[model samples]
Target: MGKSRVHWLRFLRLTSSFRRCPLSKRSLIIASVCVFHLLLVVSHFGYSQHQLERGIDEDKYRNARGFYNLDISDALSDSDLQTGASFVVPTRSNVVYITLKSKRLKPAHIRGTIRPKLRRKVRRKETNSAFTQYKLVTLERDAGQNKRNFASKTSLGETRDVYYKSLDITYISPTDTRIDSHISSIRIYSQRAPPWLSPKDVEVMRFLADANVLRIKEVSHGDSPTLLVFEGKTSVPKKNRKHTVCGGQCGVINIPVDTSEVFAFHLDRVLGLNRTLPAVSRKFSFLHDGQPCPVVSWDASLYPEGLAAGLSTVRLTWGEYQNSLKQRCWHKNISPKPDSGCFTVHHYEWSKLALFDFLLQIHNRLDHSCCGFRPRQEDVCVELGHHAQCGDPNHIQLTNIIHRDHNPRHLVFTNNKGFFDRNEDNLDFRLLEGIKELPEQAVSVLKSKRLREKLLQSLFLDQTYWESQGGRQGIDKLIDVIERRAMVLLTYINAHGIKVITMHV
Candidate 1:
């Protein structure tokens, strides 16, 4: 008690004196302590003045888009954050009322009704009927608060409501045809926005969903029809116009499909079967750490017709691949050839030759429209001039797709090596768009080729196309788009500790 109590008393006195010190010295001591504490805090929590930002971090995950990334990078897009967006539910009395900015629509009024406005713009030439409701939306920040990230790409947070309903609209139409005549079919899709969502976010998404509504109905016709899909009033392009391209409504709607059901829906079922090619490689094997191979059998590159529908040319690249033909674990089951060019590398799985071929088929759809009688070959003829190419025992290897309607969803060869090849060729192959990996169940669902073949015959040959022995150039294109996106997504998945492969096309 003597020594311990004396020390304790002294410590307490010192603490009290420090707390009760005079202003100037106390302030300096306190500031010094704060600076040390602040430095520690800064090291722990404030490494980046900006990295902590939720929406703006560049090192975040972003979707892999096939086209030029007109959308935001590695951040939740405007499409992802839907607030105050309006939708109509067909109800017994009236469509379910989605009160977005109810103060403006006024639910209190007895006769109050909200209808989907044809907010997307149509082209209008002077004295032309195509131009209707055309205008530009400039998302300028209010005075003083203007900054680069704020002005250049409207921050998703600041996007309170869509400029669509609020902005002044100018009507335009094409020269010859009347607006009423040109509008063949208008499809409007409405969904109740999640209640917790911000009104502005909802407005942006509702506009996008509604905008894609028209596209979901368009048939994969020629360039003119595809152009019509874009140029039409309901088209997102027409809506986006001089304003940011695919901006307001678009940056948000890329819903990530679940991995289980990669080939979940039929074309008609999804995009309601109407929306075309959703958003739309290669290998090296047969070597022992720069070793050799026994034989080599490779195919030429494949392509797609998945662009905006007009005849746009597409090219694919596999970069550098192996040249070694020295085969170690060559599968004799594939062919009579002893050293079947396919080799099993630990990571690079397929031999360079096999990878090239794998990537090529994955790149093309409508069945590698080289010279074959595979499922989608006929579609190639329709879209990209006739190229009667067939998957061969020696050359073109047939792939099994999940749609099974006409084409098999499975690859021509499935190795434990873990290679995946998906694409956007025709109706069947088109469904695989934007998906990073084949649904875990696609393999199981595709067990019976009978159902798939029947579906294919009906959807592709009978329901969609028949009598004309032709396929669209779309098959190869479909394969290419899917392969590219899958690579990007797989890259992200790998980073997150999810197992995946580079996967051949």
Candidate 2:
């Protein structure tokens, strides 16, 4: 009340003073202007005081609520990359930010651009004959619980022919400390079969080495002279195809081993076995942090059983085979005999394989050792021979060689390395000692001029491949050895009076 009274008295005094002095028009106008300016200042002070009471301070919430100029590069680190995490990716030019809403119930919103490093060119269909190229280029939840691995899905429209080694990806989420967090674990996963592969059993393998797929699934390491097998896959043509289909040999790869494996397949095909795994020579390369690394690979197939297992399945060492043969006696009254029941059972099939090994100069197999065999059929073996051994239990007749092939006589030939290393003069014939008959069809094919031509052509298919592995000259020697060996086998059969097993193919 006192303050109000004092303000009223002061106003009245001011009015009285003005009334006494303002006899002219100019003085009265000046007094009115001063009073209006004083009222305006008072109203501004009241507005400021009201704001202070409501606690509206922008500086206090500046850190928690504001736009950020962060790019994807700023958020990601070396650990975020799957393959070439050590590589330095270029920074993205796009902008991203986070927004902190004022309402207590409303959560913070985040937004960002996803820019991955360009690994390969995605070809864009062009109207002109010239091709146009487009570059097509994931996340973390926990230290251990949240693995940042990623796989390609057709739903994402990532089905491109070119493969990507690494991707630069950025994302934003409420769980992130900053609105924009770099996802270091971005990876591309896909599976595709190579175009050149023809076997229906292994056609799916082409995508295993597709340039666009990720290759970190299951890398195998073996004890041989440093073999690194990389497991890979490419996207299937069908959009809805599952990415996790069993890859078998179609999705597996290795360095030096594949070279040998593919060569062996060629050998098998030329020899008319048609039992070896399918494989094709392929040149593989990739970029690591922008550096190029090229490799030669043989994309081989994984079948009902691989060549390694097939070569040794039901096989026994030569000594073991000899001992087992000695244990089998056909008659109760007769002494145990080595050739009684065992010799006639696998003679034909073993003879064929012996010839095959001799031609390739593959010396790893021996009589005491049975190198390969098919799955056992007890009824089939016992019916064929009462005392047949598991490795070579049945005679493969020329008329029906393929009918009961699943039995022990199948003898899948595999791992055919060691071409020109062993001395050809002292070629091992222990595997041929039991030969009593030969397949006439196989023998005729072997003696045919076409066989020689096929062998020559097959050996020449990978001239560059053998040369790279220090075996081009060895391949030439191999051809010479094959021709000479074929003639020797025919001569031996004629001299020994071995009967021909005639099968009409």
Q: Which number leads on TM-score?
A: 2
Q: Model 1, residue 498: what's the lDDT?
A: 36
Q: Write the per-residue lDDT of candidate 1 for residues 23-141, one digit (tens) a residue.
A: 89999998999999989988877656555675454334332211112113212345554542343331122121211111323235466388767677554334422122210011122
lDDT of model 1 at residue 212?
24
Q: Model 2 compared with the native: what TM-score?
A: 0.40
Alpha-carbon lDDT, every model: 0.27, 0.40
Instruction: Indicate the TM-score of model 1.
Output: 0.23
Instruction: Locate the minimum summed-lDDT window of 10 residues in model 1.
Output: 294-303
**Number of the top-ranking candidate, with lDDT as the measure:** 2
Q: Against the hidden reference, what TM-scores do the models get?
A: 0.23, 0.40
